[model samples]
Target: MKRCKRVAVVLPVAAGLCLVYAPVAVADADASIVSAEVSGTLTPGARASVKVVVMNHKAPAGQKSCISAKMDGGGGTSCFDLGAPGTSVTHDGFMEVLKDAKPGPRTVTVNLLPRAVGGLGKDTKTVTATVGNAPPACDPVSLNRDAFQLGHTEGLKDGREDGFADSYRQSYDDAFKKKPGLTAEQCQDFALSAFQNGYGKGYETGFKEGQAKGGKVGEKEGKEDRQKGNTSRNVTIRQLRVTALPATGEADCAQGVKFTASFLGSGTGTIQFHWERSSGKVPGTIEFSGGDAEPKTVTDQAAVPAGATTATLTQKFVIDSGPSKGKTAQATANVTCKK
Candidate 1:
């Protein structure tokens, strides 16, 4: 033991031991829906395809993720798996517009779930799809034809009334001159003119109505009707009378005198006439349309002869054509001359 102790115990001092600790790196697990789109026309009772894209910000190793979509009204939920970190995945599906669906924009919502034990909360995205109007169902050709026939019938009625007024006016004029009224040929021309005018107006109105009821076909038929301008029949007229306003007395020399002629009639057509004054004749014309039973008037002025203290003037209204043709109505006025 003494010898061993003296041998200078060479048991090497155990080398000082050092321990180091390091932090473990954990991966981030976050996923989100990037976008969603719906393609194809979305008419009622029609189907359209849907597309959704999802992106993951970071993914834990071996983690699973999924994206899903649901439409606002009725399409069921659809899902697809997501890719790795910093990558995007696309999901495709289809949706249908209900037969009774209202026209306008509809929405689809998409959601993303990381599926990892501890990942970011669910991410959501929305897309819009438009629903269009349904196609028309009526027979367009039949609608257009009905419109034309309606217009023609109404036009004939209007044309007859107008034609009658025209012929009646001519008959009155001829009768006033003790001559025969409108010839067959002349009467036919008048009827044709009236028919064309009435038909054109009625056709336009009916065509527009038809277009509202029949769509494109109605428009095409309307154009054809306008180009036709077909002709038809004619008719007659009734009474006429003229009266003078202020038929008794008046005054003012420098300012002259004013006279008015009023005519009342129950028919249509143009009338030719003249004013016969103590001075001269003034020619004129007046027209009537429809079954106007109202009075129409015209005016004229006369000057007092110079140097005359008291002046008496006479004015006459004469019809040159129509049932009252050649008939005359007269009036007198007394004026005080101013120097």
Candidate 2:
């Protein structure tokens, strides 16, 4: 392009980008696009070279013909001097798809631009190129690991306590046969490869069995200890006190006998108080809860039967937590009733 300058920049595919540039004066004209052809392949994670061929309705010698090709949205342009009316030019450029490009057909466009003084035309044509999947890299260690995982899964699926060992061994042996020389420094199998793979398999099997057995034994021991109340920390119920105001009362016993229950202890727990009228056939009993600590008190009115002469209230406070959980302290108070 003598009159109009164009710079074609072919960016390296390694950078995941490709560029083609052709800068020309913009104008609308009437010219026939003889032919516009684009050919390329879409490759995942690699650059693809595209060949663009364009033939136009000819222009003067000083006119310019620019061919541009775009692949998956990346485009580049190249310009050539129009020799005759049947002028044609081929543009070579590259385009890149994403490393994780999906396997499908990608759109590629080829544009033809004729720079003519009298009047020219802009033409574009689009075609599809299939992007192929990337080739798999060779990795022996990964294969081995995959085999090991499969074996473990098989063992679990078999529902046998010791099945994992045999299953893992079999899978590992099969993998070893396929990739005998495969080794990874970080892999546990690397050192085991020196010996028969079976030995390593057996060791793993036994280790798993031992672990299961040890877990069962530990669980059983823990259960037995719990049943025996063999706790590392034990809380003891040290004292219990009960008091009744107006220990001797008459028919006024119905007036409300105040019974106070106090418990003293050194632990964190709830103290349950069970109060009952044991002496007289009092109909109702009071049950309340208090904190397990020094000077924790609970008070409730003692129910006195209509004809009862005395109300003997018996009470007990039980610890509901701590090492001394379930231990109890007992106290009693007497309320005499007289008409």
Candidate 3:
């Protein structure tokens, strides 16, 4: 007897949806099979039935046709001859679970191969059914008070172990059913090792979640601390000055203007001074001494061109380091020429 080939089958979980896999038809006008389904207790040696609706684009109703169906890993192919455009045709493709079938989910595949000139291409569908073993019978038991309390604790432990084992077993079974590549022993080992390390699995999950939350909290706290420190240091700009001096020949002959910036703060840091002029001269930057209590000053000079009537100098002072970083002040001076 020829044994059926085992293949992966992905079934739809939605109600009234069939797991159909149909290739492009070779026929001029394609025919199709839809709503193919399997129904039966998947227990070992149980009877089962498969049904589908056959449709043909060119064939009229009442036309006789042949179709075939087969399981994924069990009995051989079964064929049926039925009328065209049939509804719920239970063709000769009835199914039966083997006596040695294991207790787990099994894939049942049905292929609709019709024999017609320029027939519709092969249409295949699959479904999953759970094959179960006979459940063990419960035995009567009587326990004293201490035994009852101990039993309660043991029951909780047993429950968790059983759940863990079952979860791994189900996962392995699903993998096998989808691709029967793993031996039974391999599948069992996978489940057993996973169940044995349940605590490690739980710790890994918890650790990642805790680390992410801690990282966010730590980042927020660090920003707040920096702000508090900067506020406490209290950095300030004390004064700014601009002076213009002309040559001896003319009071307003014009030469250059001097810019100064002074800083005052309790925080020890570097102060950056930026100088600008209304005469469209190139701007310049300079550094000044900065620290607690004592004032620090920096200066820059901008040349005045011949046609320039007035000189406007602007200075911006910024604390560039320590807790007082980002604090800034500005000053401007205007010098008029005598005509």
Candidate 4:
């Protein structure tokens, strides 16, 4: 009868069973240029000291962050490693100004490349440096050739993207309306048509843009070169036009109305102008440094009264002083406040 009393013993199970954990990976975040500065006389064939401050925005701890600075036109690039999130690093480097570099302001671009995670970001800042004397007489042949090439490259890129988008949208819409689901052959055909259309449009756009750009460059350079030594030339307003947004439709009262004034001028002097509005007037001026008749635009906004349900806005661009004084162009917009 005593054998009925039995005891059970329990052993530790944690030691017998092993638990394993995989390490978690952290993704890198974009870094940004907080501030950038370039100093020293940037003369031809000289080096200018550059200082850049970079900050990591949201990268987790232990993530690798880097930023590189490259001059816009041409120069060696400098890169630096950054610290954790909310941390900033300062990098000091030198940028060389090419002997043939153009005078005036130049741009320096900063690129952020996260190492741990694949991501890219960039920012640009400008530093004005006098690389050389006022641009020497631009050679017509050389200017035209360079401008043509630049225009063609830019136009081709833009046109190809636009054409592809248009073709793809049309093809997708057409295929979607078919009786059955889109087939693989239809998809192939869509892609082929898109690419062919893109190529054709790109070539046509590139040629036209190249010719137009070349003409404009040639005309501007020719005029500037011709009037370089003539400081006594008086500015003359050659053309003036004004346009208003929502010219005859309803618009938000708070959002206001916009007016644009475009004018073309010739000669080297200052042109005094003013915007005459239904409510008030604003005085403005434009300085023409070269003799070329370049087109310039000025924009103005008209605000509606807080309680006004409907209003008529009128704006006039007037030439106050110059040979073309008294010349005026005006536009009117009728707006109704949105409910």
Clash numbers, per candidate: 6, 6, 0, 0
Question: Candidate 2: what lDDT?
Answer: 0.46
- Runs in model 3 deviating more than 4 A are 1-28, 60-67, 76-78, 81-92, 115-121, 134-339
Give TM-scores for every candidate, taking all chains together and pairing residue i with residue i: 0.30, 0.28, 0.28, 0.32
Clashes of 2: 6
The CA lDDT at 28 in model 2 is: 35
Off by over 4 Å in 2: 1-40, 71-73, 114-121, 138-339
Residue 168 lDDT, candidate 1, scale 0-100? 41
Record all residue pairs in model 4 with backbone atoms less than 3 Å apart, i.e. clashing: none
- Give one digit per residue, the lDDT tens place, for model 1 in 224-293: 3334531111112233333433333334576666777766655555667799976679999777764646
Model 3, global lDDT: 0.44
> Compared with the true structure, what per-residue lDDT tens digits does model 2 show for residues 183-271?
23323343233222433454455556634553443344335434555431222244556676655422366675666766555433223
Instruction: List, residue by residue over 77-152, the lDDT tens digit for candidate 4.
Output: 6655655566665567567767676665555554445554564434444444334442233344443344445444
lDDT to native, each model: 0.51, 0.46, 0.44, 0.55
Whose lDDT is greatest here? 4
Inter-residue clash pairs, candidate 3? none
- lDDT of candidate 4 vs native? 0.55
